[model samples]
Target chain A: MEKMTLSSKTREAQSPTEQWMRYLGFPGGILLFLLILYLPAGAGLSAGAQAGAASFALALVWWVTEPFPTYVTSLVLMFLLLVTRTSNAKAIMDVLGMEVIWLNLLAFILASMLVKTRLAKRMALWLVVRFGHKASWALLAFLVLQLVLAPLIPATAARCVMTLPLMIVVATIYGSTEATPNNFGKNMMLLNLACISVLSSITMTGSSANLIAVGLIQNMGGQRVYYMDWMRVGAPVAILTMVLMWILGQKLLFRMKPEEQVPQVEGGLELVKKQYELMGPLGFQEKKAIAIFGLVLFLWMTDIFHMRWFGVEISAPFAALLGAVIVLFPRWGILSWAEADIPWHLLIFSAGAYAGGLALDDTGAAEWGVRMLFGGMNLKGVPFGFTYTVVISVMMYSHLLTTSKTVRTLIMLPIIITLAKALGWSPMSLALPAALCIDWVVGLPISGKPNVIMFSTNQYSVGDNFKYGILTCTIGVVILVISGATWFHWLGITPSFWAVAP
Target chain B: MKTLRLTAFILLASVLAMAVDLPTYTVRLQAAPDGSGQGIATIALAGCTPGTFNLPLGFTAVQDLRVEEPASGIRLESSERNGMTQLKVTLPPDIPAKATLKVSFRLKQVFQIVKLKPGEKSTLPATSRTFKHAFVNTQEYLIGAYRVEFLFPDGLMAQAIREQLPKPAKNEVGPRVLLSKVDGHQAAILQFNKLQQGDDTSMIVELVPTRRSFGWLIAGLLLGGLYLFKFKDLVATKQP
Candidate 1:
């Protein structure tokens, strides 16, 4: 198992849907595009709007089925938007320069700082050594580590990279490997994946998708969502979802035996401690990384006080940028320019998705579609709970359709905002909760970056990931629904009892 | 002598037996981005006569009115009526009596400085332009079909507000229902089939311009270039 290559682990059996999509997704996307473009529908829709919808349809199908790499599909999407005249060349090209894209770049830089100094691994090792006496405690240790690292490191993939080796070591101690696996490994791997993905919802900077949602709310909904505003709603819901997922995985889904719960290998607990001791004491670079990360986290948390403290507020991107600048500031900084692990391809993907979404909006295609949808559904007299539930469920489960959370965010949030506005509900009321669901990208290996990393471990099968992922997502939907009625109501993000539309 | 007189009178009466029939008039009104408008009216006439045909142009403050035969493309200026502009078309003496003529009347500034009423404020940045264009059959003779089209500017995206208007009575012929074809190239079309003499049809529309801008494109390119040049190798290895 240890000698197995990464591709061998990643090349698991494909589900029927994936197989079909792999074969026919490209041509199917083209067909859909042509059909929507030439169809004599919606006499009131503008030519630009019609063209925008067609371009988006093609991109959506291609992104979901993945006929090409998602980034390649995105490049194609950008080209389509320009050639189809759905959006101007300048607008489509400018998507790479959006503030959300910048924030994602700076965030990866900050993550690289933590990873370069090995502070992330050190922290994870310390937690596991402190709490790896039992299998249950070990899992909780990882969960806690994820919660700790989520805000400090905005990139989930980076967090997963830091902890993957540790998870592999601990799984081996439990006598679980690709050749021989057990319930303990399944629970361990799946729970950690859920943790890394779900805990990201706790902060607005947790993912690129969250920031895009915020930008849409500000631009389209005319409501600015501050960092604290997101945390005020997102933190509770995400933490609860993580806790429930842990419980469901340990107690119900993957129950370990008494001996399996303990380390099956000799001196398993000692091994973790030995690993922690091998790291030795925290070095000067680790200390510097901590101080910089701490300052950044402090500024992020204390944004509400910035206006009173210094007569101005430091935005999330600016805060991350300041930290990144220090991390690369001459010899005093920890990393050289080359050391920063910025994924230009992912940025390209993000730019194209943003361009498509903005084109739909600029051409009024998104709004027109939303209006037509509501007009057809006749949701005027429906109760608010039902509507909220539908919106929340769709958003939470939308990971099954598209793998990229950034694309999903660009596709859904504006329509959700428009839907809410069309229905006379507050856009934030629906969009914020949906935005909180952006990081629940754990339903498949291709669902998220972290899932891909964790899946490549090969300690669990695709079936295990799927079953556990679907159950965990359903559990998440229930938690969010209840929170929408109770916790969010108490926080006033939603109405109490959902008595009346806003 | 009496037989000769009867024959000459029969010829004169045959020449005097000219009649005119107004079948349909389709008017196309196009609005410019600068708030000006132009219109083209295609009028179908049968039973041609060598006499003047007074066609009422249902527009206010019409300017640069020009008429031409659709088939021949021959430009001709028709006399206009004061107060409410009417086209005075003179049929030629050599026109075949059985031939139906199609004449095109082109008018500029048909909607001169239309005063668009302001609508309610919305969360969107677009401002609303609300106005009404009335299509009235000012002719004394009944019109077979009177069609009017109001078109928005090219490449402009807008949303039509759903304003409720009272339905026409069952016994009465209210103006034909307004069909807003703002989608694609279709305009807001109003068709009044068999419009009675001097009857008018009008509908109000509120158009909200939904144009969006793409600023900071150059800035994006600069940043992207800097990243590519500074960390170009990362792009090869760190592809997501």
Candidate 2:
């Protein structure tokens, strides 16, 4: 009784750190407001720099503390960008205005409905009964599905958001002994799903960042990497890597005997069936969710080939907003008045990230960074082909600091380009290194959006991620560096290892 | 042996720092009424050297300098400094597309020796700045600005004008980038924007420090600073 009373009293008194953290969320917003005001007017250093810095701090807070709703922070970031004039006000508010976001919205809505109705569990068990005789083969099928779909779907978060539910279903079927998945096999299975989707995105159409790289490369007057050519290289690399990942999984993590008897579960199957049946008739909400999802995909896939045919120049963002609108339609039920189901805070964080990159441009913060890089190399690494290796290695390791691939790409690509040419070398050397190297990050759910969404399933942990991710990335970087070197000479595309003359 | 080597190094360094004069000569021409298209550009070099010089194929040797020709392809083969070398070639009035008049670049070495001394400075007049895609904003820094300069004989009446081009503006000294024919001489300097930044001809700066060992640290830190400013926030989450 004394202990209970003591615990109750303790609950009534908050700790110092916790108390400070609670206020950290809102004060952070106001601190940024002050910082924005201090920036010099024309260049936007004071405001833009503050925005980038503030957004970064805010993101750290949200990621660690979870003080505010993720979507609200996303919205807060958008508001910050809007209020500070960091980005086009319209663009900032309507960032989700892209079609790809809609596809994601539609996809997520459907996935949510499927899970909420227990249809996902039913599907998982059904598939396991049909295919679980070989665990690796079942996992391979899931891996292949993600790879094929990633190019079409640009947003990793949306893809992971949809696929996480399915992954959980697989985890349930594979039958780990522990109630919580502290097992090696289950943990690796979760990571394999993410790694495959993340790596396969080398094609111009694969991810938004890839497209941005291609566009930037084209602008450089270099020959464009045709869609087919990109696929030729990307598809093979992805498939080979997938096989390698499977081998690693089986040998190091799984190590199950071939004769390990699979349980022929009559009761388990029956229970799943009964539970699915108890969910009863498909409600209006469930039917509407699937239909809205279908509509979203229809809009999303317009770019599969005939994009111009429909006069669709709208970016992936607007398409997302349009698809999200379906949620508001009277017939298809979704979040009520106060519950938009959007992670506004996370969006704000993303906007703030965007603002930060913009600030780098406006304040010449990026230029300042570039100056710092080549300031030392000026005397020794001349004729710059030698310096190329040094720059590539630095950029590769930069992933250790951040997981937002877009932010890294946005900030580094130009500075590296400028620095290379200054050293009497061509900018072409930086492209492959930039696109292929940033994927070196694979450690935690907080590391990539897909990893985060995968984490939302609450299955994997830090240890699981660190074990496979670090090793995989280390191997991945080494292979890519070699491949890049080989391809550099083989393609004979740039002036390096060769020269242009009259 | 060591003292000899040190003396040699000091001598070479001092020579590089000072002006070494080459031999010079003078040949004057009176425009005699028939010299309607004739002109001359000379300077005062107290101690300067004039070396091998010649006017090659593209230039029409105009002893009289009275013809009006049409050739923009003409380039000066012989670069004879005025005060440094006195026998100046006659220049054409209008150099047209096909006409072999005079301009410069892509000329073979010519042979002419006139004067020598060791103290006067014959200006080594050439400068180039890298034109590259350095800006981090839109990938379009190439379509911006370019500046070039040309020096003539008379410092007082000297004017720089550009013509027969796309976009022209007021240069600091010359007509910005667009120069039309001035005083009917085929001599001029031209500048235009490269197609885009990051193009093959784009200028990039390599901050090469003078000290050999220190340059690497400077470059690494520079690259790190850039990587940080540009990407510090991204990896900020990964930080402890």
Candidate 3:
């Protein structure tokens, strides 16, 4: 139902009904948030708890349909949750403090600074110059830049935000409207670049979901999946899937040829230099924020090596909040807390996510869902492969239906374990692959955090995102199924604990 | 008058959607006597524990239970009394010592599914057990004075040997013995002389507790709002 770009429908601006929806959504959202946040506070409240959880559906629905900023809605919900004594401020906040949410905000701020300084644009310009004039080569370079940037910037929306202007730059230099071959080449280079950049986030560092999983895993108090350790397994799988995505995109996408001459941007880097000059004499606080960000990265990197000495450790969320305070308080300078303006929606959605997960637990709906899918296998005597295939396929298909990657993982992991236990089949056959492949689920533009942020800009249409996403997810799913399992099997590395036990 | 009526209608609709009340009903179990020094027959629901309802009730469940040295003649019973439907169980005579039975049920009225939007779905999914999917703890069910009957072959008379028959050896697929009626057309029902485990068996039956849908209207509103907001992006074709 969503069209090509996010703003495809919003460009003309608000309508009468929209005005009413906005007003209604705000107060109504507050009311709904209250309902969701409260109502289950007393004892013997299973139904109430479940209803409280299910009411979150209304929050998302209202946010999407109404005129209010979604993040503001998130803030409202958080306050209500605490105010109603639905959960302690500490407990609700713990979910917000989960690494993924903070990492996303930190990354957004950094990307914002980069955009403000024109640093991202200059880099894009330099990149285009270095890998010039050849369709395949340009696409390849774009792919490389995306892969490199994804790790540094976990927010897909941030990447699109920082680089979209550059894309427009390239598209303008080549083809502003429709394209001839050269324009088509730039088109291929830029659009595919955006798509691949989004695709690259399947790895933990590149996206919020992976970090969320790591947080949950750590919170679950078992294997402390280090940033680098996650990268250890995640990087290779992500890279392989990305490479395959490029080949498929070029083959399935277009036949445009590269141009002969490169864009002469001898003077483009000046904008960044001018920005630094215009902003002038960076203050102690700016320097401090930068220092803290650096320290956070250092801690994130070193955490894996000395998980003991350096471990007990710092998370990206705490680090970002620390940076925000340092920038706001220390030796007043270029930036202040006012500038940080951390979007509360990120935290709100994260809380909603936490609450949604609780509801699934409360209702036993998730188990009921998967059991129905696999229930007949033990009775109807379905073939083991069919059973595995059905389970695996369902895991893959779930991406199309839902956007939250962790929710899919939560649902899939338990079902796979339960089904494997029932059918005497190996669990890794489902678990390992789903974890490795969950990021590859690109069916809709909004499937992951990056996709959600990308949609916010309205540069690309929903249809475009859906089309591109479905393409990558399909290709990525097949590649992971074959290469991922084969590679893991060959290395004698089990994808899951159950597989080893099974 | 029209405005008042409209407001009242709206208020009533909202109430119906949001209201939830405590469910009233009690779980009741039934039994009989059997031979091989014991007696047995199927346990049937005599009726609701208290006041009945007009509500439709039936349970469906599948479970894994293992019974040892079991003599058949066990029956799980379900029926209606007054206006409400009831759930009950019947046992067979001469249930060998240590015999056990496993039963699971899934209910229809209690089963529910509603569509969700991207924003509404949760990361930690719900663990749903269908009413048809539940576990019964038999060892927990057997206790004193609660008569469990075992149905024996040849319809024989009272043998103090009844207490001598080992508690129905748990043969799980619902404690086994072909559950055939012994003589006197009387199926030997095993009366629990004394429960090996606890007599109070707590079995959780999952039912569809809530039914509500919200995603579609939201999607419609989002699209409609977006369409209205970006009128320029959506151009009209002229009908020449």
Candidate 4:
């Protein structure tokens, strides 16, 4: 069994061709942008819309290839849009200040507080102590942590950041180091990446992408989707898929040895318990963090109550910002501004992507694209069942083209809503299912923020993630389709095949 | 007796034919704060004899109705038929070949706040409420340049605008005073130049954040102070 290690040497040893390809990605993106902009004026899109499309293509390329830092590409995208005059500066800045961006920022601050107070470590240790006797149980414990935190955290990247330290500790405890990796480390890290990305779709506020989709849906004149309604449709799919992921990881992909299955060291449990002891009892800061987080969770869950009675709507971002403010307040707060570990790069990237997306909508590029592609196809006459299958399939595989889930949601939901409107079908039926597939961005290492973060662990290679990811993604698609046809059909979200003439 | 009956039938047939040949009516409505408005509609009747003409006013109550004709005092009468108010006005018997009849009315328009989600049904106190959009039903006529002006309460500012139609031709933000009240407010006016007959329109105007959210800032500061004093070590120590 080979142990896992985080070595910088491995990353520096890229082949000459790989390096050249990385450098070529930027110009390639620029060329694609120009090609789209120079398309025949008769293509039926306004010049501004064409410019928006060009910038979007360029950003997608840069995000996937990482010729520069992902954040730098985001900056480049903003600069390009400004130079092209696709949208004004004020409009682009507004996109940056949207509630979705605020939610992510506040969640990052809260995550930093959790890490600083060592509360995250304490919780992780308690779970390890209870379930660390066996490798399978430890994996299940991590999965359970993700499931519990999914609804409350709101940011998949933040959840992954909080859980990564625990995962590394667990991997180390299992005799898995960088130099000598084992099946246990590989399965654990890969599963971590998958669970973090997939489970986010289970709640409306689980990720920024979900919120973006909801906002677009509401903006398009669809019925406002409530929190409970999202959970009712998403929880079953999420829970079932997570269980299947565990089974696939343990049984099919990585078979474990007897020694690896249990604690490899005689005093493995002792080491974890001693670490827990070193932290001592819960400090006042830990208690305060818990209290604030609890309040935030309560507000997020019961937003409907406030909205109905007080006529006050406390959005997820507002709730998270409340908690963060409480945690970082001077003298009373647990952390200072300097202590907070917010990832500005991710925020910048998201802001630029959002700006491009808004331009796509405001300039009518997405709508035009949809009309041009599907206008003459007469998709309205197609059976609803077939259309549902096709939309779900396209949404599932779309991760191959773009890396950011926010960008994917921005590009796809509007088009799907437009298509649904044209076809005389319910927008929610298409948009909701497509939105659920937002977090299936596990096909490549750079597919999602969490995936990128997990890749830094170096416990698993890109091939390991792709091989497992593709299989599970296929399984997920099947599960989603079957659910849409059967379970969701019973729930009236999708039309049953029996009801159709096909 | 047969000749008298034929004369009566001829007169009735002539009136029916004139009704069928009446030209289309075009109206321009301006919505104000507090959901009240006024509109002026022009009915063209070239090359046709003048008679009593009926115009339907969707579902709004008209406070006053009149016909604007020079040197003519034409009385206007209104009645409810099939859940709609129909305004009847009489034109001169010797109307010219290219004359236009203008009808105007003060509207006490009441728009329903569109409920997009199930949880939005509960009644709340007026002070804490913020409505995103209102729906106006315009299924009565082929409206031309139908405009709506949303006046937000004092201290509220417009943030964003969304409409179901292919983006509004003219969406401008300005200042306005609340109707029947002394409070000043911001106004967002959205214009739709042409609306197909029997189609309804909806608009959502998002508002800037109110001062109520400042409570969160204060709470955060208090909590931060308490943590800094009680658990200084935890705050000072950085995690690995």
Candidate 5:
């Protein structure tokens, strides 16, 4: 009961900005909504699109400000979408039934399996024993782990589920809890979050959005972006940006003092090592948990071959569901229904955010918004370097406004291709580089699936997230700009910056 | 018996599929000098049977509708339902599999007129009034390549314009989109490879009258001559 009370108190605790936002956020959202709604519509912007944009603006304000709980704000946004005629009733409600939400739900159950079976504790102890001497090394170790898993597990949420328990356990050992989080915990959790998102851009098969981009480039641009071609360009930019983010995060953003850098446990590294030794060999439950997770990972890794081998593809959600069913099976499974740790609030928040985003998409607001964005630019005779920089920046930062990477790709790539055709520049020159930046959805908790999962840990505030996220994004933009001028020019992905189209 | 039923179903499905095999669908919209317009849709169908097929003209309130299948010599009896023209084509039993259908109709309004008042706006003088011609594909299917040609009346200059995303603070700018010339008229052509059901493919362009440019030139010359006449003494005093 005391523990429950402490956790609840932690939930209620808000930062100074959060407190002020909650106070003013409600009226502020309404004012922004009215301002955008009644403003003179731009070209090609229908009334429906205007209303959709207004509704999305209000939701974003409320979400950032926490006028209510984030989930309640979502509920309000969903209602606003309906009443404003931005989206239909069925569409608003159907967001909960989306496959991403289902994947998150089932993933939480699998996450519970790892934690409940003591398997997570074992792995956490092992990680701590190996790299827990300093918090920086421990963070780097998880970073490496994410890089290794990014190519293997195409589903980012699945990777987060597998690693979330380890993060939590290791965080507690470093003296960070849900009730009381320290810089070590904040840096650890947010770094892993950045890694999962940024590393996905390193490979062509990193995410489904990457594949969609490839298809768009091939069909619309008539040029194919081979897997190796993507990795050749994508790997260097993503890796260098991640490393810079890691160093800057610790040294600058969420700085850890010398005392905080070391393990805060009573006995430190030796104690963590002893604890791992004390756990002894893998027990029945650990082995069972491993077997289940191993099978799930195998299925995830072999998704490309599922159609050829099994005649049907088991998507990420279904594969996780399969594992969840076994994990909850009668007496044989590792966890029971009561022991499963699923956060319905985050799921509701996710659903509402998605509903709001889809409303923007369905009402043609998103497309109109992108069109107006490019239409306003005077890139007629601009140098290729300047144009490339603007395009890459827009693509990298657009994740802040969108919820789904696939929707973003669908809307963005065509306009980009069209813009390339309008200009004399090659379509692949702009669209390919833009496609490489699709997975940089690391700006907010509502930005991506793994972000929501990581946010639910309550280790960091939204302010911390925005600061770290925006900084990381800026770093990524800078690296891409530099690379586009140098490395990409050498790679033939980009032509000379001063060269005019023939 | 099950196999026979399946075979029959497959054959019927194939025949129905061939009924709407629109390999080449072209729509040409011609805007006359009097703010009125006409639309001609030419569709090429392959392996079609004798049946009634409804073709949507994407305009509500159409006038003088005509439909003809040239190859099969089938005259269509038409009626309007749900904003589409349902044509009942009666083909002979020995008709060929391929056919070409042509439908022509007059439209209510093709362009919205924007008259420019002299000296009303500071930046752009009363040079030309633009007519905005917009075409939206209202069909609920993926149009592989929607070839639309907008032919303005002769001596009117046309430039296809594209709307940009919204900027709250900045002034509006309609960037010029690439257009092809069809018989000396600016033709706004769009390809809808990713168009989905209920999704609109809009092509917007601004048509300026060439005579207005000449009018502006005459006005400028008269103004310059008047200025010289009115300020001759002042100009001579200042010139020394």
Candidate 6:
């Protein structure tokens, strides 16, 4: 194992053409901003809201192309809103400190603690060694391990990094090195990437994109989707997807050799065991970190129960912050301020995006955009089942066109909610399911951060990802549709196709 | 001869009551921290004889209806007609002249988180927590006065108050208390002397964060930090 710096692993040098394309994003955003501001306001939207629409457009362009750092784009968007009087300074500033932002910050801090305490490494090794008797079992072991780590580590990329070394070691043991990749290694790596990305959909705070989607839903006059509700709707689908991916990878997609069926390398399990032993033993810091996070998870899952008994509602973000504060407290805490890996860039981007969403809703720009884009479709008369299927499919396949999950969510969710409302359907029925698709960024190498990171492993080609990725994505869509119609129906999330609209 | 004279006087009083109009009713609402409220409706019938008094409530499931008047103890019955909950108080046969009735009951009140428009600034302090309480008019007749006093939760300080209604005289229930506002609603804080009718009222109150939450936050961080330092070696890295 080698020591790795976070930035060095994630950052790649840009090509001249790519750099020029990124530079184009700035003027492109400015042009869009001016175009939206000058366009004739219709549908009874206020001028302030129209201006807000301009800032949202600007942010969208920059977010998609990355002319500036995502956080810098966020800051620029806020400043534009202030200058254009789209929103007041207080409102803009207040958003930066919102509880959701803190939640993301806290989640990052918790992830950092896990990394620093070496708890994640230890947990991964123990799972692999315990479940690595057979090739199929080893693959399932990694799949299960990634799912377990999904909720605890919010960043998909971070999870990939944590598990990558173990994966390489396992591949080497099977004689499936990167240069001569075997069916087993391809299956393991591809499934590893796919499962990590897919599992993020199950937890409310599993990914930053999920949080942004929730925020957009709340901004659109919908009730907050708590942790329990998200899990109930998303977890079954995620589990089913993982099952299908495993079957496809093991039997159908990647052909395994007889030698691959069992551990051929004598010391493979020893390697993992050695890594586990290196951690020495769980110390006080590990115990404390575990205890604090355990409390956080407890509070998050039982928020409603606690609210009933204690009269104070413990929101997901607040619970996370509570855990983070304890973990970062000086002298007794596991991490110092400098050690905490809070992603300010992502937070700033979120704050700006939230502000833009607020402006859109407040200024009636979203409503207007909804009217313009969907008004002529006559979607109201369409059958609920058909409408729902179309919505889910669009959300699933949209990953092919964009890279950033947050950008995808920020653009799609508001429109989806507005369209749902316009169609006289419940916003949650459409928006929440659509939001779940934010994690399905697996259609292409450039579709998501995790996909990109996995692609860089050199074990699989673009053709490999596209072939398997499309198959599983199609299967995932089917599973999601089934859940929306049956499971979601049972939960009263969606009414039966012929039932009266809510 | 005395008995005959008393009967004639009673009959004469009953006839006089038939000509007098119903007294005006005033409702005062006090909101609690847990989102429930207590309301007192005072009926002033200074010159009229007691008869069937009907009170319509803006909210439903009225509970604990306590009436103070009619020494014989009048029976109170509730019925829903035309989607409205009406409380019917049957006045005693031997009614007093120039009487006032006080009716108090408990009703559930909903508070919503305040939504600010883009670029709209809140008057509440940055650190103040806020919630909005709405008062709707369910009565058909004009109300003499509508007053509301919002009680802030303990450890929270009321920094500023905003109301939906215009030109309301603001006062403290004790000292330095503020209320919140809703658009197009009128409500008076701490004082109920003003006369308002038909229009709905809402109030928003901003409460400054108390040391309790801050203290818990700080204390939890410090304690957890200390615990980590004590057991820090468990996290020490070992490269294999």
Per-residue lDDT tens digits of candidate 4, residues B1-240? 999999999877755655313344445444455556566656554554555656555445666777775314334678876656776655566555555667677766433444558656643223222333332333333444544444554444432243344433211111111111112434544444445545545454433323333442354356435544654442243468
Estimate the TM-score of every prediction: 0.55, 0.51, 0.51, 0.59, 0.72, 0.50
Worst 10 residues of 1 chain A by lDDT: A1-10
Q: Which is superior by TM-score, 1 or 6? A: 1
In CAPRI terms, model 3 is classed as: incorrect
DockQ, candidate 2, comes to 0.02
lDDT of 1 by residue, A1-502 (tens): 1222232322222455565564466666776777776565465565556667787777777666665655677798888787655677888888777766777678667766776787766765566567767788888888887899898777676566556656766676677776667788898899999989998999988887898889888878888898898998888777887888778888898888887887665666676577679889999999999999788777766666889998998876688789999999998999898888776766666677667767765554654554464456655657777888888887887676554677677767877887788888888888999999999988866567677556655667555788888887888888888988888878777765456554
Per-prediction DockQ comes to: 0.06, 0.02, 0.02, 0.02, 0.02, 0.02
Judged by whole-model lDDT over C-alpha atoms, candidate 4 comes out at 0.65
Instruction: List candidate 2 segments past 4 Å from native.
Output: A1-107, A116-119, A134-138, A172-193, A242-295, A304-307, A314-391, A397-411, A416-430, A438-452, A460-472, A491-502, B1-240
| Candidate 3 structure quality by residue, lDDT tens digits, A87-108 | 4457666766665566666655
For TM-score, the strongest prediction is 5
How good is model 2 by TM-score?
0.51
Question: Which consecutive 10 residues in model 5 chain A have the weakest lDDT in total?
Answer: A1-10
Compared with the true structure, what per-residue lDDT tens digits does model 6 show for residues A367-396?
445345444566676767777877888778
Which segments of candidate 5 are over 4 A away from where they belong? A1-15, B1-240
What DockQ does model 3 achieve?
0.02
Model 6 misplaced regions, further than 4 Å: A1-10, A13-17, A127-236, A242-273, A308-314, A328-331, A371-374, A379-384, A391-478, A481-502, B1-197, B200-240
- Say which prediction, candidate 1 or candidate 5, comes out ahead on lDDT: 5
Query: Which is the winner by TM-score between candidate 1 and candidate 5?
Result: 5
**Per-residue lDDT for A181 in model 2?**
42
lDDT of 2 by residue, A1-502 (tens): 0000001011111244543443443444444434433333221112233344445444445443334444455555556554433455665555454333344444454455556545566556555556555666666667666666666665565556555555666665454322344343354455554454445455656666666656555555243667865665455555556567666766785465543223223455455455556656767765665676566555555655445666655454455456556665565566443433333333334444444444444333343344355555652444333454556565655554454566566556655655544454545555655555555456554455555444433344334555666656555555555555566546653344323221
Off by over 4 Å in 3: A1-103, A132-139, A145-237, A250-292, A303-312, A329-333, A336-367, A376-388, A484-502, B1-240
How far off is residue B48 in model 3, in Å? 32
TM-score of the A chain in candidate 3: the value is 0.60
Looking at model 1, give its docking quality level: incorrect
